[model samples]
Target: MQESHLSAAPQRTGNVIVAVALLVLMAVGGYFRFVGQNWDDFTSLHPDERFLMQVASGIGGPTTLSYTDPAGLTQEQADQRALCYERYPATSGIGGYFDAACSPWNPQNVGFGTFVYGTLPTFSTRAVAEVIAGLSSDQSWLTFYPIHLAARLVSGISELLIILVVFSIGLRLHGKWVGLLAAALYTLTVFSIQQAHFGTSDPMANLFAALSILFAVCVQRDGKLRDYFFFGLAFGCALASRINLLPLVGLIFVASAVRLLPVFARGVAGYEREAHWTQSAVGIILAGVATLVAFRLLNPYAFNGPGIFGLTPNSAWLDEVGKARYFISGEWDAPPNWQWIARPRYLFPLWNMVAYGMGVALGITAVLSTIVALWRLVRGKPGALVNAVPLAWIVAYFGYMGLQWVMTMRYYLPLYPALVVMAAWGLA
Candidate 1:
């Protein structure tokens, strides 16, 4: 008993050391993410950030509780109260809660017609700004400078969460040392740090993207109902942050398929197969339901106004999304589209990722580790297939985005966590 106790002491000490190291790494990462949040001062030099702030600033609680007839109001008053009747005190009861148009949270009702991105990031930043304004009784927090800072702070917090998620993923895949290494590496990543300093949706979207991957891995490992449910929630949050992350939903199907393999093998061998199919099917269905519910809640304006179901389509929002896609495809003859005219598809993104975004060493290490992981899986190596969840996502996302006309660096933000994990795996 004494020998066993002495042997366990080192292990406990090691765990404490790891815990302390992780905390220190997180502190350093938080400092990098939060610093220089006000880099552009009050000028709002970044066009995307400026537009997002404009939409956020426009979103607020209704000033009046009484419903006013549209016919009695002037054009200005009508515009000011565009969907006022759809929201709270103006349209009270439990019905108002379900009626998205009347909720006062939808950006569409605020009169902005061209909101293309997901609503979660803008809503999150605005919520912070509103709290500050309410507490201080000073509307300055709702102004350009302070609001943008709030957005930046939110973005920073999201990235900080991402670092933690990356660590967890690495720990699951390898062990604590690999997790620590990946977290430290991601903490120092140039692009992540740069994005964290901006008041944009990219970091928030990236956070959800990382989370989806994490939960997908969890489902791959345990094949539990709750894991699938959480994966769906993360996927929905990712979709609500950026529609571009719609591809991440594929991870759910992949995990489900992997979970079914053992059952299929057992059946083929004439063994008594357990009733796992029903469980997996239920999990998948539950995941889908969770995804839709989360998306609807976070992005309420996607539907037409005033109902418990709120299932009717909003044609204006659909049209704006279509236009945004067209512009991104370089078919709109816009100024931003010109940059993609002669740019080679995959090479441009690859070059930027290696040279500027990830730095050459880490990028090369990730590529090599991914190749090694694939090779091991091909050889039927034990535990090698665990990498498939993230590897598949990386391939699918890069394959689709690399072919796109707009090869912006931030478009590849979702790939960072997986890449860092792979890099850490290689080094370990």
Candidate 2:
């Protein structure tokens, strides 16, 4: 039977190859669609790249504490810091928002700053900045062009890492061919290419999401403590990068705790392992908290006390500045004439809309395939439901969609690799 499975591998490989080719073609198409709008402009505004430049300039570096005045920052500093915090908040280790002297574009409207743009009193931006700050020590290297270049190099490598991780997950769960297909599909997917190139937190966030899935599977396969540690680390990184992932981390904790419960019921062996589990859990929580504190100490809000999470109004400081930039003049808000209702209609034309609306169709296929695969695994189907990682992915997607109405294409990008793999399995 094993030999037969091996024999069938080549056919699977061909399907994956075709799928990957199609995905790559799509990415090339997307690149042409959006990249032409202003490749350099978009790249410059890339949030992560912007932060990297700030880090290079000592905006949020190791010595952030020394430069900041306990007496409260100057109006110039406050204004700049406010802008920085709106984009990149302060954290424990990383200094207060830097790179005030630089920043060609403000994300107030045309940028991805709306949902998360607040003063430095929050965790999400600061948490991410701390991790980035910790990544480098030499404050001088954080300049825009230099850091942008460095970010590209690092992000490119990270993209490859994502590919490898995806492949490994596919291989372990499905087969060599499935792994190849997923990797190939990922490589060709325009959405992956676009996000991977952008230095925003999304790519790293995607990496962390994938890591959670990877570790979850590993735990299912072997129930190893090391795997759980990896899971914790991945979850930590995810939260550190984007707090939108906190729910996913919560799922991991619950899932892992459940996995360990039966063993704990058996006693010593389970209890002995408890310390290791505790450490792993602590590591995740601390990575998040420590990042927050490190930023807070450096850029303590003038009017507020120490807290990693809270909200403070910027209107006071802005009012004092005599600067309307923070007000209607320079503010970035949804355009008054902007029609949110027609967004989906504008995105997909009539015929394409019908086809693209096929998320429902694709979703139905995924559900049926997942059920059949699961049944096969239980009743000894040759391929099994092991290839249905995308089902969990779909669950995450619907959870996001139902919880929030604002669904962007990027939000669904990570799931494509898994979905393609599942589709292949269903076809097989």
Candidate 3:
């Protein structure tokens, strides 16, 4: 025992050192992305950020309205603001391209798609911008960066946390070296790097998904009630961050159920010893309840449901639903002769994302994750079933993403954490 303890100490210390180093590296990467680029990045920011900025700015006419004074605008400044009201974020010359449509001001019909990612984050940043916007001393800081930068920083921090989660999950499954390897690859992944400096729900959802999977692992290993409850909360937050998490969360519950099934086989005898499966079962129930509460907490509009959901065809959520329907059908809006079955489109997008985004080495980990997970199930090795938690996420999520008709780098961000974890497992 003494020899084993002595041997483990250096490894533990190494894990700690690796964790700290990776944290600094990921943070610096995120920070530099925001601060590094000297050129006109404001115009290059995502349309979603631009839209949320206006909603928070009291200019875009958000349905979930909160009124603010053009807080710091001089008469001329206010007049210039009026000129750009309901217009694109930045002019075309800089980098801004789209002439985004303006939303009608209605507090009641804010829609599921709008607030699902949370009204609070954008509102908070906007409030900060209003204060700075009102400042008479400096005009340069008055632009969208004050508010936009906050959102980006929040996302950047979330990405950093995701890197840590990937490292931790990998370490749990394998050894410190592999964990470090997986995390190093994740930090440089294309999708992660692209969204690391942008402010939006994608990173938030990605972080929460990582948290959910982490907590699920805890529940599997220890069968602790809090782990189950925390897992539920994390999954719920993922949902609130974006509806895209729905399928992922569903798989988690299914995996949890499968993990707990042996308890049923064990009958009352399984309740003996140090492990308690019954309480863990209760904890899973609490996870469901917690999910509902958290969803409503983050986006109260979700509580209204159905007819009141998006309110109109032009509402943001209604528009999203239409897209989803089109997505499921896998059709493009091209002429009939130009169109085909189209499901194949989502596959290449998934493949290209994994191939280029993760780079050749780590991307193979993602591509092979499904095969390894299935092989583990077939082999029935020690901890093979325990691996199901992450496997559920890996298999279901990639399948879900691969079938969708539309794709983008941001859309692929959620897969990075799981990819790294599974890659670590595969390598081990």
Candidate 4:
């Protein structure tokens, strides 16, 4: 017994060693991308920094600044403000591009972060920032870099974990080599690497989504109660990260139900001697409850207090929402719209079709995989849901982006791992 236990220790340690090495390699590759490609984004001071300073000024701070805006202000007032030096019309030289230059110190305008402030509560960054400030009594946003790194690192780690879980699922369903290929393909996929390098919420949310599915798989495999708890935690984390995570969440419950249905019927038919239905039921309930609570906690309104939930006043939200809707629906045109989907927009008659082409390619393959996986499940293949998780992930993600007025491969970075996995599985 002692010798057997000791032998097992080495295998466990080997697994840990391999996982760590893979992560170190991934980190090195991510660092290279960060320095080589995203160096501009990191080195260039955020244009919004000036805007933030202006916001800081109004709360009795010393950084008072002014900007001119012809649309919303009088000619005399617009001329006097330094930030508003160029009127909106003047900047429209290249399809109205040159007309909207604002004064560097103007604080009245809000961009992505501020515009989506109401959605902040459901994000982890604010909570992480609050924790740091409260603990250190430091108010500087620059000091928040550590917090940001921590959050990003968690996202990176989560990607690695997803690889491991996906590999295990593949190994259980197919074989060890298939598992390795799936994990390798996922790790090397272009989209996954890009998302892993960028410090964004999407990668972290994707990690959680992957884990939630993994846990659900375990439950379907008649895994322990602890697996359910973990599924709940991961589900909650995903919800907290992005509202787009809803479809993935819904899929988890549905997948669990679908898998469990046969199991329940089997138990009732005496096909199996005993079935732990109560434990499984409790796990599912726990996952749902945890996800709801996490969604509430991550909401900025919940963190900051009520009334602030909307971030902007009702009027502002309405205006922004209208713009956001238009921008998403393509009713409002953008100068560089649909460029990310395909290079050389001139090659395509309409830029919209370029994105559609990319979407169709990804969507068709995913749909086929889904149909195949479902068929396999009906044929009594174990771990069908587990193997299908990555395909499901990609399909759900593409569906979400399809609703947006604009889509970019970069934005779909989080779903890259799933894509790679699906491709690998299909090829293998």
Candidate 5:
């Protein structure tokens, strides 16, 4: 088996070639698939993609966190508006109404201010690609393909990195075969791959999300500050990419506790590594500082003269976040027999949306695997410790989503890699 062979020895040369080929194929294919839609025209793009592309093209900017409807708005227009939280009530994270200084362009304290100007990383890539293509940066002089190509390149890279991270984690937890299978499943997902093809922050955010969890897994085994540093860097940047990922910060810690508690209680030399308060404290501080610095680098406008904890109401993102939360009322006023995964037929779209894309077979496999894994966990299976991170993260994210009424297929992406692993392993 590949697992035994890979465990017995590292075939560095073959592995690199195969991995590079796969990445190139995925990126190029994803780029072609999107551009094949006549991407040269702005109308063909997704609203968010159009926003980011226009920003990359010239002087257009992203919508503000406080965006309200303009007159004669279509559903598309309203949907395009940013999900600014109600400033009147103030979200749990902040006080008072929205700040005028941060209204249109710099609206987010928790995330980078760039939310107003689209994803800075995508913009930065467009700028660099223009230089490489020898095109003038002047809006009037530049051609569109380079910028469009750059967006695809950046997103595709992000998706590729996500697969690599998933592969690594799967390899670590269950050896080569399961890792490869999980990576393949993650890469094959239409939503995740589609995220890569688009010009949004999601791909980059997914990269960081997968990395944070992968590093969190590493921290479980070793409890190293360096691991925490990496985790912090990724976690901070992931939040910077999208504030919606805030739940993951807590989920990772929960996984750590579930993973480490047994060792501490039993004093098992082989299974346990002591988690020191000093180490954890310093690591957390380092993570926080790193997060601040990273968010600043990604979106510097968030940093006003004296922001609190690197966040000011002017640029903090909590308001928009709160608005997003409140927007979805979870209005499941349907018959009791209604399912949650069947579009209008389902009260909630969470499971329905997932099933629509994950395929019936794979989805069924995931459910069964989750059941077996949980059953084992209930029975105190020793080896189940490593599997706990994915399980806990899926549960945490799902539980959070269960409260949300706005159902997006992409929203479930961060949970994809972990679920894939459990499914594949459980089947075997």
Candidate 6:
């Protein structure tokens, strides 16, 4: 008993140290994210953020019993009315949310015929802005400056959450020290800090992506039904924040497969330890159902909506998506396309990521860590396979995005959590 107590004393002390370290890291990271949130000075310098703010400001409940004809209104008046959040009331009820024609909630109804970005971040920001507007009796909260600032706050919070989730991933897979190291590294990442300062959806997308990876680690560790469900939920949220994170779905299959491998190895004997195939199958199905339900709920505008489950495809949204894809593919002749025209596929992105985004030392460490993780997996080292789950996502996502014509640094934000985790593990 004395030996046990003594051993536990050090464990408790270690846990306390870790907790304090994490708090300090979070505070520093929050400062980095929140400090320059007003850097644009109401100028709407970031075009993407400006567009998001416009959509957010425009979304609200129905203003009338029926669609207001825009024909009579001048174009400027129509745009102003579309952007007015105060025009809708709570008394308008849930039905207004699904009304695509004049429901202020719909981006398409906002006179912006094309909204290619994900809806979740915009909706979330608008909801928060409305609450502030109501509480302060300040309608200015619905306008561009205050509202975009609110969005930046949301982004900052999301980045902080990403740090927490990355820490959890490392702790679960490796240890407390690895988790702290990973969180510290991610907190210091320039790309993450920059994204967090913007009002765009990238930080939220990165948050959800990190959350999905954390839950994937949970699934790999325990294969619990809740783990699978939450993994799927996080994945759906990630996708709803940014369609670029669609590749994260592959992590689900990787995690599920890792969970089921032991069952295959032991055959009938594996069933003895609660590693039943039926439970895993059910978990996978539940994951899929949860993902679909979450995606639908968060991105209702993507469907023909009169309610949450409106499953019929929204043709306009689909068309916009296709058009955006075509433009981004560089097949269309556009000003932005010119920069990427002669740029080499993988090298350009790699150079930017190493040189400016992650900094040189950290980037090299991440690469070496990934290679070491792969080698350990090949050698069948203990814990190597679970580590491979994140590596699989890193490789697959990077491969797909690296090949794309759009090689923007923010596009690679989703990979940072896994890379930091791998780097931490390698260092430890």
**Best prediction by TM-score:** 6
Clashing residue pairs, backbone N/CA/C < 3 A, model 6: 60-104, 60-105
Error of 4 at 269 (Å): 5.5
In the order shown, the candidates' Cα RMSDs to the true structure are 3.9, 10.4, 9.4, 10.6, 8.8, 4.3
Sorted by TM-score (best first), the order is: 6, 1, 3, 5, 4, 2
Residues 1-428, model 2: lDDT tens digits: 99999989987887777567545644543443234323575357755356544443333323232223447566865665555445444342222232212221112111122323222212233344345656876433344444554444334444556666676677667766666656654555455566656555566666767777777666655556667667766665655455455555444444455445445554557556776577546644654454345333332331132133443523432342333232222233555323333444323222221234224454445446666765775686654434434455555554553333333455454455555456545654
- What are the models' TM-scores? 0.90, 0.53, 0.73, 0.59, 0.71, 0.91
Query: In candidate 4, which residue ranges exceed 4 Å CA deviation?
Result: 1-38, 41-114, 117-177, 264-281, 302-326, 334-388
> How accurate locally, in lDDT, is each candidate?
0.82, 0.48, 0.61, 0.50, 0.61, 0.82
Q: Could you tell me which 10 consecutive residues in candidate 2 have the lowest summed lDDT?
A: 102-111
What is the per-residue lDDT of model 3 for residues 324-426, given as tens digits with 9 covering 90 to 100?
Answer: 5565454656553243344366666666766777777778766787577779787987667866777777777877776665555577677778877777767
lDDT of 5 by residue, 1-428 (tens): 97987775666765775577557645654554354433445454576666565455542232333223345445643442322243322542132222333333233322232343324555455556666566543543234554666676777777767767887888777876677677666666666656666767777777788888888777777667787788878887787677677776774575457544755655566522444544555666776676666665555444442233445543334444454455444454544323334554223444553566566677778768887888888799888777777787777877776566556666666777777778877865
Clashes of each: 2, 15, 3, 13, 10, 2
Q: Positional deviation of 51 in candidate 4, in angstroms? A: 9.1
For model 5 the local lDDT of residue 62 reads 29
Candidate 4's error at 408, in angstroms? 1.9
lDDT of 2: 0.48
Candidate 1 Cα errors over 4 Å, as ranges: 62-103, 266-274
Ten-residue region with minimum lDDT total, candidate 6: 61-70
In angstroms, how far off is 411's CA in candidate 1? Answer: 0.9
Q: Candidate order by lDDT, highest to lowest? A: 6, 1, 3, 5, 4, 2
Which pairs, if any, clash in model 5?
A: 85-323, 108-315, 108-316, 108-317, 109-315, 109-316, 109-317, 110-316, 110-317, 341-352
lDDT of 1 by residue, 146-220 (tens): 799889999999999988999999987788889989998998899999999888899999999999998888887
Model 6 ranges off by over 4 Å: 61-95, 266-275
